[model samples]
Target chain A: MSPLAENSGPDIIAAVIGLGSMGLGMAQSMKRAGLDVVGYDITPAAVDRFVADGGRGAATPAAAAKDADIVVSVVVNGAQTEAVLFGPQGVANAMKPGAVFISSATMDPAVARDLAQRTEALGLHYLDAPISGGAAKAARGELTIMASGSRQAFDTARPGLDAMAAKVYELGDEAGKGAAFKMINQLLAGVHIAAACEAITFAAKQGLDLDKVYEVITASAGNSWMFENRVPHVLAGDYTPLSSIEIFVKDLGIVQDMARSERYPVPLAAAALQMYLAASGAGMGRDDDSSLARLYAKLSGAELPSSTKEPQSL
Target chain B: MSPLAENSGPDIIAAVIGLGSMGLGMAQSMKRAGLDVVGYDITPAAVDRFVADGGRGAATPAAAAKDADIVVSVVVNGAQTEAVLFGPQGVANAMKPGAVFISSATMDPAVARDLAQRTEALGLHYLDAPISGGAAKAARGELTIMASGSRQAFDTARPGLDAMAAKVYELGDEAGKGAAFKMINQLLAGVHIAAACEAITFAAKQGLDLDKVYEVITASAGNSWMFENRVPHVLAGDYTPLSSIEIFVKDLGIVQDMARSERYPVPLAAAALQMYLAASGAGMGRDDDSSLARLYAKLSGAELPSSTKEPQSL
Candidate 1:
């Protein structure tokens, strides 16, 4: 679908129902864009932190949605999204009729479509809007959002989208397309990151200079954005999670589920999923994704820089 | 080692002992740089074609090396390189003493070191150089050469390298260093190509707009140089061989061998190699490396654009 045209609207009261790193940054971005933002999170400390940062906090998602013109669900998956909308004190009955719900969780496209259907039945619009660009860009209001929904949903969510995204691809006039596209991106991302880790660690195994390998590769055809972005963490031996290994374990697990249902043979993605699983299984689940290199290092007894605050190994 | 410094040579003559696309291009590049270049190939037609392209052609490697100051062997692997240097009518003894032999084949590092020892024992310089940037870059003298050798070897090969390479990385002062780096690159390159093919065809199976996927992915973190360069071929359904599947089969085979000997587990490269092998076995051995997409399409019954003169599917 062609992207929605440049949109404008009257005052928007936005409810951000999850003040994690990504959601908090997105909430601040909405406030900066002149939206009256209400934040809520299951963690009271998180809600307190958001309120301390000068945004109002709500006792529950339902409370946050009560006065919201748009409710942005920035939770992790379909289950959490469903809970926020239908659990005790759910936002479905609390929000005004015609108020839009924007789901930014990465979940099964089928789940996204079903959520859209249920939300529409409740006299609300649902936008399947899965976000990219991580927390830093989230804070900068420069996220890339892949979204699909009806024209009414687009109109209702325009203010939040404009505030939160640098690029919003309006995929279609229905849900699921955005989720499918996000899943594809996730598949490639997972594969590329694992490949990069494999390359760097294997280079280390060969006793070649890691920095030179990085230089030559970035200048050569073997480079990916993941390699360029994540290798520094490996080189530093840092395992502090910029994006953890568990994220890919979950994302690629979703891909495997989706591909299996479709009977699609995604050999590369499947292979990549194994690497993430192995890394997560090796107890690096919460470590940076580049820790796949550390996994290889541990398995092969190939030494990487032990320059991290604490050394990471098997 | 730092790249060979700029040097002046007195009437240097170079021999290119391979008239394939890459060798012909390198020979032409050398001739363009004012080096008198003579070319040879196993296929008489290739030599004839080179002669037809305004070049001198030799009957054999020895004949090509007879009056040369630098011999560049741009063959396929260590075995071919050994044949060029020591087989019947080999170039090793035929070339003048002190003339450098530059081996631009991807091979195991141990094999490269062995070949370097043999060449050096014959009172000659052996520069372990494996090339990148495909035929177009070779034709334009813009190839990137990862090279390592003695200072004398660098000085001896400098003129031809200046003509043939846009960037020559002086990896170290050893013959195997270049080969090691090249293998690392091949490991990543092969994996990326296979991953790109898997991603696009998988995207196709999901009924995505392939063009839009190309757009979104190139803008997203999932992108690799291979994906950006190769997916257009899939989008157009053209499996015309830009680089054949067999190339990766051989390269990744070498990687498997190296990693096995090193006791390093290269699961990602190993996985990628299987896809290339499967594609080759499925009769795409000479088709574009991107034909992995064709394989996925065949296996999953995914429909891609059949815009090519010939449809590509099982």
Candidate 2:
């Protein structure tokens, strides 16, 4: 009983139900890996863009999932994920029986477990797969996936997972565990980025060159993956949204909620959440997350390096 | 003229004014470099240990400073650094007129500037040099030094600096810049460690294996130099103090003060300081800084992996 054999034909038909940055890149990766991939997005421009990039595009989630052997929901949050799967014109009923549904949204682990049980009852496999590494890695097919599911769900999602990820951590045989792991990553990532912003702006206030601070820190114990990746943007004064301030505001909120449910006191994550909220509330919601430094600078009255272009509205 | 020439007859008499972990390793590095080095500590046992390690020992700051061409003050805080340099029977009045003072204590930039001015007024040079890379790197003579001073101060301190550090960042031609850079590093380092502890302990609460969390995080974007360095200690349940919780309590205290003086709000460092303070208040002050995870674990009521040995007092 091959997982792919559940479809009408031998070929695996994959449908990516989000054509955002991560989803579009992952759709391209699957297409480039010679899988038959169809992508869909609520925005027509994104769907057209995916189609223009030599991949098939669908008009709706139901239409895309009508024959997909694997349906990957790469949307933003639990609400969006649930809407795509169980709302009007939802994909769960559209997906073939025994097909796998890979949920890659960052949501509560409890939500993932509930979705897995619901989808399993519908005779569809659910693998809780949350991703890390940003847009560039997603496009290059090098994202890290923390995935968990039953054996059959893992077996079903393996092909698409292998095509899209450089590393896939099979965390457990249950759906919520992958989500748990991702929350942990988000906790650290959020805190590190906020810390980098705080330190760099503090350095700027103390009259240290931002570039020099970046150089010294990356070579020292203070360095983090977020610091090394994002501080360059601060040094260059680039606020282009590689990842937006709102993303962390959302993710760290989820982290705090999870921690609260567990009665875990994550003071650092809570602190980081406040910084993200500050940045977002200060009209930097859509700016590069590195705009955190700008928030710090604005609050401290410190001067940062000018950007290469005219400033965007704060 | 060579700074070494300021000492008697081609011998560069170097004195290490503290014999704690970092200071002891640095003293050994200088001794291995063949400088005539003398180490001093308030603790007689520490001084005896240094003597047993084939290094000369001094009973007081004056005895260590007398005739020394380079005096490295590797004490704990601003007050201690000031005491070693200017207390009753202090080093300033005992050193050769042209001798250089290399300050490795993490302190306020203003204090470093003031000390440099005071030392220069006494016909001595001062290099505001603060070190990073913990005891292991110090032992291998591979520490990173963020240093700033006058050209002559840098020139005067070069021999001792070269012996103890693999990388020397000459930040500026002023005394405070090095301390400024160091405070920035401490801000990031302290926050990263707290974030790592928060993430690992959160994972533990989620029932994810901590060792796996450590493995995944190091390979993920959540990774930091402190995370990679300190998390293994948490996994091994080893609370042996490579660095202690109190170190961050002091360093982040400096960071918070710097931020407050600049009117900069550093929420992440402030939050991290609270975690360290909480850990210290919980009586884990002398344990490894990674004991932060234990603090989180205790607070969250999560069971951590057992250590190979009997538990130390919390």
Tens-digit per-residue lDDT, A97-175, candidate 2: 9999999999999999999999999999999999998788899999999999999999999889998999999899999
- Give DockQ for candidates 1 onward, in order: 0.77, 0.87
Q: Give the TM-score of each candidate.
A: 0.96, 0.95
DockQ for candidate 1: 0.77
What is the clash count for each candidate, in the order shown? 1, 0
Determine which window of 10 residues in candidate 2 chain B has minimal summed lDDT.
B1-10
Place model 1 in a CAPRI quality band: medium
Pairs of residues clashing in candidate 2: none
In terms of docking quality, how is candidate 2 classified?
Answer: high
Model 1, A108-172: lDDT tens digits are 89899998999899999999999999999999999999999999999999999999999999888
Fnat of model 2, as a fraction = 0.98
